[model samples]
Target chain A: MAAAASSSDWPGRYHHIDQILDKPGPRTDPGFLAGDGVKDFLRGQAKILVIGAGGLGCEILANLALTGFKDIHVIDMDTIDISNLNRQFLFRQKDVGKPKATVAAEFIMKRVPGVTVTPYFGKIQDKDEEYYMQFNLVICGLDSVEARRWINATLVNMVDPEVPESLKPLIDGGTEGFKGQARVILPGITSCYECSLDMLNKQTQFPICTIANTPRLPEHCIEWASVLEWPRVFADKKLDNDDPDDIDWLYKTALNRAREFKIEGVTWSLTQGVVKNIIPAIASTNAIIAAACCNEAFKIATSSAAFLNNYFMLIGTDGVYSYTFEHEKRQECPVCGGEALDLAISPELTLEQLIETLTERQDIQIKKPSLSTPTKQLYLQAPPQLEQATRPNLEKKVSELVPPSGEVTVTASTLPFSLSLRIAYTS
Target chain B: MKKNEDAAAKKKPKTSAAQIRVQKDLTELDLPATMKTNFPDPADLLNFTLTITPDEGMYKGGAFTFSFAINTNYPHDPPKVKCTQTIYHPNVDLEGNVCLNILREDWKPVLNLNSVMVGLQYLFLEPNPDDPLNKEAALEMTKNRDQFLNNVKSTMRGGYFKSVQYDNVLAR
Candidate 1:
């Protein structure tokens, strides 16, 4: 059946489901046979929702397509640009100015004919929940922590409230610089993304850094690049009539170098024509990270996998990558609240419900001692074992203090190196 | 040289949006003459090499090689960049992956090549362990600052990271 669907002629020959087995040609590239390898790994015919078409999404789409995933939906409100060429390999110059989804779908159709690619070209809204319900697995390839936090809360309620014992939610990706990390959120079986986010947020301030950290970035030794518009730039230079072969290297060098000049601190308008140079290599990391994501997702989809839930897959440029696992130690965590089903319910809770239920109730109260994350000035000098070993204990202790589904932040250590803990009422 | 020629020959016309954007970036690029672009193929503008000899930072003594692979769609998209050279820093992965955000979500078409190059260079002087590509490195940098510094020192001298030897690295 898989072979009939994947053969080059499979599209033409197998018009009906009954004609699945009779087709021949050694299945040519035997693409469906590839899918057949892991068909049993999937929990029924699962629908997949991809959230971006940038560097990570491009690689994820290609890897998934090559892996023979048939029912896949991608959402990205972006157009193809010259800057993307550094990492996104799916489109070409001819494809510039076109919708990324449309071109991406066409590319897939040419490369792998059987799979269906639906493109949602717009900002993903709360109303998009109806479309999100169709998928069993949600792969987040976005670059924003706010978006990530929102998706975590929303998907839990929409996709599977129970946070299936067997299923794992995988967030595989890297950020602007060289930092790349992946984590697996197993709803009921392990700590969900929200629990991790709450913990990470209260303790380390990972959210604000990932969101507002841009201006803080020092320039890369390499640079971000800009797009090139031909015929115009050329004609403007009065080169349209010049012999193409006569383009002088020395003269071109001076002209090109001139393009690199910029006036710093000039009002924003003064720097208008200056182009940014983007490093293509960092763009490639998106592909590598995406491949790793698909590989892990495939493993979870096919086998009863281990070693992934609530762990960080950290990658380095020198090819150094490691998986650091952090498991929730409490049966009823103050942060995660025992991975309770109610924790995954509806992103519709209002401020009134939260304030009346949380503030007025005896069971609830915000516990804010002081944020003492590992990076905090207070926790700088403490022994690694002191903080690392005490994390679970601290989490349990704090979770017990906060109300069910309420949040808390704790800081206790000396100056330079203090440890902090943040707990959310997930139970 | 022949391989260079072949790579160059395989370069298709810069029709991909990425190539066009790169070309535009190059045309308007603002770099010291010390920086240069090597197009193994004028046709394959997306995949090219960059050479930078930093005048500042721990990487000041060294010359680094980087490979840039642009997506078919140029300006609107972020380019995939990799460090061809192995540098010991919290942000750069051992496999040559960098941790720059402008190339990721913060990316705007308005950003050009100089921004990324400067960002990559800044990594050499001060690696941000808090926002790390290698969490262990970040952890170690945060937890064991001296040792992290030592590891970086040894690696740059063309020694080993963990047990892997990176002795054949090229000089700038």
Candidate 2:
């Protein structure tokens, strides 16, 4: 494998580093660094999209040029921080704060002139139809589960609609400390991401301890099943009416906790700090995941390779690497089963289906009548306080109105009142 | 309406953390004379224009323009790029989509603007259609080599391109 990469020769051209090194007069030519075969491979001009420009993306991208993948597109919505320098080898101390996609593209172009790089320097959600169709393959290096699921659903669904027979493969890879897992979705030939999610959901049903071998929370403790009642509590006392007692309790229990929860979950926790916590080891694990994803992608693009239609996992924690072949034609699986051929998911129908299921659920019903509406919404024009009470209810209410989840927040002050009247209709 | 208003109300600071980094990248950029960079809007450092005049190969004498849009997320992400100019190339789509790896899927934080510019230049010198932005272009180049060459020549010569009017400048 190492033999494939030829030694880099200084082609005697002015490089990016040369500018920084230039003392005064003439610019120093650092010479070119493309392997002899690099030019040949890049000559074909394959357009590839790397979803995340994180640590894994950096290593994989560097290797891509050496391997001859020239026309590359990168999509990442993140900034180089002081912390990322450890293993995100593509960046330097000077690159801190620059856009990763722009900087990465620039870095590759300076070293190798025989390649074209474009950067979709925004969140993947910002990508439109033109953005999605431009690239041939999408190499997912994103760390967020939401991002991974979005990519899988969007790209795979888009490909299926436009070219069902040639549904594009989505290679989602990630690392958790010492462990990395990559799943390849060949669309028709194998289980798609949704199918994989179903499998995970099934695993959860078999008792968490059985699957993960970790102890579950004690049954006695309240695990925040619902905050729905809190909205009514706040409304019943009218905290906004400046009742000192009502305000104190609200702040002590609900308001303070909610505020803290938002900050903890969104600002600090949402960041891919899990990967950052382990430093080079986690980053290296991420890089391995990326390589595996790309390897699987290459096979899908060119022709069938050994690891086609399989889920490969590398556990650095246990120093083990193994793959589990997912049955391509599983009658038991709902996503890729025989029935799915006719009931294939479409992007247009996906949102509608999701909304239908969300609203149809018996759990989420807003109270009717003007008196029952949350006083804040009635006065300040906000979502009812009840809407913010529980996670599932909140998600359902918001997702019913809007298509996407994980971004929007619903609080108790946003929920509606008149529960008795609303319950009468349901009962 | 509230969401839209909230989004609109949020003032994007004149010098965002990402923009500051881009400025640094630009100052340190060792751009060749053949390649020049321009900011369409001085206020928006995130989005800029790149003009490339190839000194050699099939795209010689032809000028190409590309648009670069940098998200607020800097150095840790790749910038969005599109071909602003319509050109006859297998890797570039009629809609101004480019077949660049770093921009798409192979980008790393370690790579910078300098690397991307060089890659764009490479596309001009040697257009790769294998992972083509335009599948038709790739198919023609791979399966019908002669027709592909003719199409490229005609487009370069400022002739009618598939019934669509295009301004063509001769190659050096």
Predicted structure with the largest lDDT when compared to the true one: 2
TM-score of each: 0.41, 0.40
In order, what lDDT does every prediction score?
0.50, 0.53
DockQ of each: 0.02, 0.01
Q: Which candidate has the top score in DockQ?
A: 1
Expressed as tens digits, the lDDT of each residue in A95-139 for candidate 2 is 998888888888887877565678868898776544666666777
Instruction: Candidate 1: list runs displaced more than 4 Å.
Output: A1-44, A159-168, A194-281, A304-307, A327-427, B1-172
How does residue A124 of candidate 1 score in lDDT? 66
List runs of model 2 lying over 4 Å from the truth: A1-42, A160-166, A198-281, A304-307, A327-427, B1-172
Task: Report the C-alpha lDDT of model 1 over B1-172, residue by residue, as the tens digit.
Answer: 5334323322311112233234335434556644566666533445777777666655566667778877643444557677776666667656666777776656655566778777766676677887776566778889988888767656767876787665434354
